[model samples]
Target chain A: AQTVTQSQPEMSVQEAETVTLSCTYDTSENNYYLFWYKQPPSRQMILVIRQEAYKQQNATENRFSVNFQKAAKSFSLKISDSQLGDTAMYFCAFNVGSSNTGKLIFGQGTTLQVKP
Target chain B: GAGVSQSPSNKVTEKGKDVELRCDPISGHTALYWYRQSLGQGLEFLIYFQGNSAPDKSGLPSDRFSAERTGGSVSTLTIQRTQQEDSAVYLCASSLRGLYSYNEQFFGPGTRLTVL
Candidate 1:
């Protein structure tokens, strides 16, 4: 079974600064997918970024990026130029690659607060 | 559908009562999943349904937790004799099928269940 772990239960960043949330997972499979999801007070879960285990290069979105170290089983999310809107609960998830069982296993989640 | 949708955005039920939560997957999406999120916690996989294949219920915590997807579009998760521990946000997600596609799971606004 795959298990994702987010060490930090809460994180805070000053407005316009950067914040990095740490996540690690334990999985026996060599190939898999890692994802970051954000849930605001509205309670809507939205995909933030994703990384494929096979890809050596990290994945970057508009303001979100990931530092994926496959060997270390670490997939961390970095938010640059953080704004108040970035305040939310973020979760890390894991899934096996191209398997018939595509269920996602998620970490406990980290609540991020962007303070002005 | 425009996106995955879950019905009864909030549910409050007494212990030992039965509760049913509904989900409507995005149109054309063949993969649907259910997840549970306890307060201030990460998500836990509950179940997954793909096309007409047998649904995966491995993540279900107990036999009291059962889900069914009808016509491969709408799903209902029922918790019989709900317990206080069953209080959590129920989330639903869907993704496009096919081995070549990126396994991006789009999530819905979850149903918050509060068992008293």
Candidate 2:
């Protein structure tokens, strides 16, 4: 079984600053996918960024990027130029690559607050 | 459909009562999944349907919880004799089939179940 872990229960960042949320996972699967999702008070899970385990380069989506260390089994999300809108619960998720099933496991979310 | 959608955005039921939650996957998606998000915990995998076959159901917490997909589209998760511990947000997601595809699961606005 694969499990994801988020060490920080909550994080805060000043407006226009950067914040990094830590996540680690235990999985034997060689090939998999890592994802970061944001859930606003509206309770909608929004995709932030994703990284493929096979890719050596990290994934970057404008303001959101990930530091994926496959050997260490670590995948972290970095949010730059944080704005008030970035305040939400952030979750780190994982999934088996190309498996017949669509099972995405998530970590205990980190509530992020962007203070102005 | 525009996106994955779950019915009855919020459900409040008494203990020992039966509750049914519905999910409508996006049109053309061949894979659907169900997950439970506890108050402060991560999202737990429940079950999934891939073109009508669910090869893996090991994630289901108990036999009292069952889910089924019909016509490879809509799905329903039923909890017989719900317990207070069953209070959580039920999330549904849909994705395209095949191992080579991007395999990103689009989530729906979860149904919040509060067992009293």
Q: What is the C-alpha lDDT profile of model 2 across A1-116, one tens digit per residue?
A: 68999999999999999999999999998988899999998888888998889999999999999999999999999999999999999999988776657478899999999999
Off by over 4 Å in 1: B98-101
Q: For each candidate, what TM-score against the reference?
A: 0.96, 0.95
- B1-116: candidate 2 lDDT, tens digit per residue: 49889999999999999999999998998888888999999889888788856436777899999998888889999999999999999998888873433577888999999999
Per-chain TM-score of candidate 1, chain B: 0.95
Task: Give the TM-score of chain A, superposed on the true chain A, for all candidates in the order listed.
Answer: 0.97, 0.98
Residue A68 lDDT (model 2): 95
What lDDT score is found at residue A11 in candidate 2? 92
**Candidate 2 Cα errors over 4 Å, as ranges:** B98-101
Supply the TM-score for candidate 1: 0.96
Q: Pairing residues by index, what is the TM-score of model 2?
A: 0.95
- After TM-score superposition, the amount by which residue B116's alpha carbon in candidate 2 deviates from its true location, in angstroms, is 1.0
Overall lDDT per candidate, in order of appearance: 0.90, 0.89
